[model samples]
Target: MPLSGDLTGDGRISPMRSTAVGIRSTRNPRLEVPLGPFRPPGLSLTRGRAGFGSLVLIGALALSMSPAIPATTVRDQEVAGVATTGGEDPGIVGDSGGYATAVAQAHPHPNPIGRTDPGGVAARAVVPAVVPVVFGPRTDETTLRRVRTIRGQIRPKSVVASGAGLVIADNMMYRHSVTIYDTSGALIRTVKDRVTLAALGWPDFPTPVSGAPVEAAMSPDGATAYVTNYSMYGKGFARPGWDLATPKDRVDDSFVYRIDLASGTITGAARVGAVPKFIAASPDGRWIIVANWASWDLSVVDVATFREVRRIPVGPEPRGIAFLPDSRAAYVTTQYHDARRGYPAELYRLDVGDWTLEPIRTDLGHFPRHIVLDADGRYLYASMTGDVTVIKLDTTTGKIVASVRTGAAPRTIALSDDGLSLYVVNYDDDTLVKVGTADMRVLQRLATGHHPVGVTFEPSTRTVWVACYSGTLMLFHEEG
Candidate 1:
């Protein structure tokens, strides 16, 4: 059958026909994806009587159709600037100046404080798929808290918390991935949705077949979660955080999966620019900005329509993303480690009002990873890798005002609700450190699981949740 229509709903995957038998490997991570038009080479068209007369289209090509389930058709809409497929917008409450009002509302369901993962999944949790190894040495904090570790896959990369206390962690290697927890440092549910897809008519859909979920952001009202598939589209599995894509080189164009937090269903998927890393929803909840690593740009999506409205160009390998409370401008970290691009990662301010990309003043050996702004949005906090310091940047000056020493490779940093405390996740040392924003002194040194990549402060429980690549979700709470 010839491939026609959008395989994953991005015009990039075009239709094709072949006369010779061509077998393409489904697991080839190095598949050559042309930037010019991309046509699926999955079909093997051979010399036969019906070859010329045939027009084969795999309606379920990448959708992973299940033979037992009945088929359903969903029309595509011309939304924002791009097209959206899958299903209708049921979460949208009302439209105000093109913004989806319902989507911006927070989830009303509250989280349990101090308690952990759903229904004691920790004690009865299934054995690790692989022999369990230590992510870090067990310290007093680990022994004290009992560290509610949600183990499933090997590499749990990032975690995002919803307003209602829903914690979702990104699993890099396994299928039926994405472990979930509540506000109490307890496992709530596994994001693995096999039945939902089949019910939606895609029964046999294979899991990703390439990419995996890395970073996610929840809508203010807490109804939806938008997840970025780190390198899912073209050779995504080969790289975890960033995927390389150029207009003429490999396609590497990525996708963001829109999931219903309550339903455990993937409602829709939007195609963004190549190798999308960090995703952030504007405070106003009208727009979602994604930092594309390879294309050296940002895909700005309208929340109401879930479509890419603008692709803002920035520096190479942009990772961390932070939106101002007013949603006027955002601070982003452009990693300095790309050898092809050369030295000193830059920090740029993207003005949402005019869509202007301006770089902050700084130079030399400053490798930035994660960025978090103060509650008032007047100040900014960033974690720099090479220097191993959390540098405070004044919004007005755009220069580092203060710096504090910490463990190696600080990746994810979160600020307390009142902006009094800051939490930094050191990937190399596997420690979660809390620092006072005022004095910039090390407040707490809590050990974490292996390759601690994601950290978030939960207001409901007043606890901090950490997602470890060693397949553990470690939770820390302060005692009175």
Candidate 2:
């Protein structure tokens, strides 16, 4: 079915019309897709066995008439179950192999403070025209090299740099919900996600509910940390959130826990949209923005009140978010590919002041998962799972200046404090790649544990931390 109208901000499916492309959904609860008006072309829906046979015939006919769809059409299916294999030696790339670099022309009205007019003239008219560029790596010197690996029952989905000179591994419903490590890779403590919602302001009923931690963000002072729960596993949560679920599913809402870093205690909790994934705190420490994967929107939480202030609809499967240095704007990645547009995905720029969004068009391939900003906030580095490459964009001009192929299924990315290097993990390849930001060159690559899904750069120790889904953590240190 083709998605027809706008989402209603609440976790409900929008109007959809059946007709066009065929989409096979996964059985994984965490990998649900949003329901839209995507209609399979030339296929008719029926309730009986005869209708099923007719549907198959129509699908086969449509496939024969059209070009084969790329394997990336189904998110993560390409590498989800693939074996972790690697034989490449760590080395630096010298050039992009003559691949083209896409550059987006600057819009006439480049004012950053502009709002989305009611007519959407600012949103539509100011859309930059992006020139297609060949996706590959540019060159730089190697600095970060593999140091060691820490293995155990830690099934981490993401690793974050807590401001207090610590690294946090978010273990989603694993043995431990979160694991804390010092910059030197020493285990500090493990915190469970079980909390009393009534104590945190939800007074309807009191019960000890456990949360499946997915991602986390630290406050400016590092005194506090906010972690997103993939799902709640106790009372008050009836319908679980799915990774590939539509709004119509009306999945149970999740919560973000505010933790006191010193005591490692969940001090507060705020309800948010379903399946909240990537999260970030504004530079000025005024607000916390969460990218709700299933809800296709953002929950803005006020730091002072520790409550969700507003929920704004972005697009389907909003995954990554990066705020500007001044806390005036944020960049979000809606990684869901739209079959109707026949394009990969979209990136949006949110006006923090007014809660308005402007879609930034790009040729970056499907599933742009993780994004990070440079120290100066002038350039943005994004990891594209579909393209298996990382592209750098000039924030002021909105141009794809450079790109480099890392490996298959590059997930989380981290930028060096000095803004000279970038670290990315290749989930399918089971490798960590260090790239020089100056030219988007591959500085070095190293074999990691199975399914290295998350990476973070620790400045205090100048070391790189990686979280592997195979219950291991890899650490890389800078020799320079």
Candidate 3:
């Protein structure tokens, strides 16, 4: 059959041919033939009839059958062919089965990504990969907390009984002395120089010497006072009881005299280390420990025999000695030195039971002048050249937990009876500071004279005593 619709050789279709193709299928033709536009060159009729009469006869027959064709029938048939073929909707043919299967197979629960699928079958969630964080296990806090909670159990509320006395060493005009004040801040008696000189076997000197009483110690019962006399010889054969030097008149030996507290009489005298800076008795009052500033050794004396026992070798410029509560250990503080030369000063813990000394591994900065321990023994407080260091000591582990800073040039520290407060003597500022043990907070500051050096608290009197280098002792109490 001829192609339907506009099949003419020219661009335009005649109205007659358009109508013929539109109605060709509805009509009847005398012969089976083609209709619409004529074929192009090199075409022939299906039935070979070579004349125009035959061509006209075929045209008439196609016109008679034109009613059988419908308008735009060829376009409809082309669309139907494409639909039945695979060309149209290729994506649907490729993915439809797999997509349907996936939708049917999804879980009906929450997914690991914390999300839900479109049909609410699964939730999307994320599971983290495993990772471990390791740390050094420490029990310092538990130990400190336990110590603080039990501090008051063994500490005494106050000193019930107290004894007072004094020891004096003579100077040129005025006798330098220290009076042991009772809890009431009252001087019990005056200890003067004549008694001290007589006790030291220095009988008669026409000219008075320019020396003073440097330090003193009292017996446990307060019955006797031992005073150290600092004296120097200037000219001629040195007087009795004073060492005569070769050229510079430096006294080779110093005297420690014992005095009767009640009678004010000299009882005993012995030569001790030169420039004795401090004197302390053993816990049982059987031995006396003295730190000689000019010497690099400590002198130990048998209290009963009044004789030297042993001189323990220590660091350079050792100044302070503190015996542990059990009396088994004594801690000494030394002046700072160049560690490169093996002279670095440190805090030495001396095993009194064996006389063995070991340096405490701690960072005390430089110039640890004095050292003290807290009531519970959890901490060591050291007064260095410029600050006070509160070292949290682990006695079992032998490590330091923390080192806290304090005022400038702290010389000494005295812990209160309650163990909650610490009083520091700042030599540079001449001030006494009360610090809280728990939080390391400064509670109070009391001004004093120039160069406050030593600090001690008398529990019976509830007063804090400060030894001023400016020639006076200051007493501080709550100003109510």
TM-score of every candidate relative to the true structure: 0.64, 0.70, 0.56
Taking the tens digit of each residue's C-alpha lDDT, what string does model 1 give over 1-480? 121221122111112321121122112232212212222200000001111123311110111111211001101221231111223221111111211111112112332233222221112221111111111211212211322444544346677766454667776434435656544333445564222222323334333444467678766544467787655532223432333344345445666777766545576666687767679877666778898866767899877666788887665567778887667888776654222232112566779967876545324125666788875667778887655788787777555667788788787888754356778888778898888777787877888876677887654333467877666777664433
Better of 1 and 3 by lDDT: 1
RMSD per candidate (Å) reads: 21.5, 19.2, 54.5
After superposition, candidate 1 runs with Cα above 4 Å error:
1-147, 193-210, 233-248, 337-345
Best by TM-score: 2
TM-score of candidate 3 on Cα atoms, chains taken together: 0.56
Clashes of 2: 32
TM-score of 2: 0.70
Return the lDDT, model 2, position 191: 78
* lDDT (10s digit) by residue, model 3, range 403-441: 556666776676654456677777667687777766666
Q: Which residue runs of candidate 2 sit more than 4 Å off their true CA positions?
A: 1-142, 337-345
Please report the TM-score between candidate 1 and the true structure.
Answer: 0.64
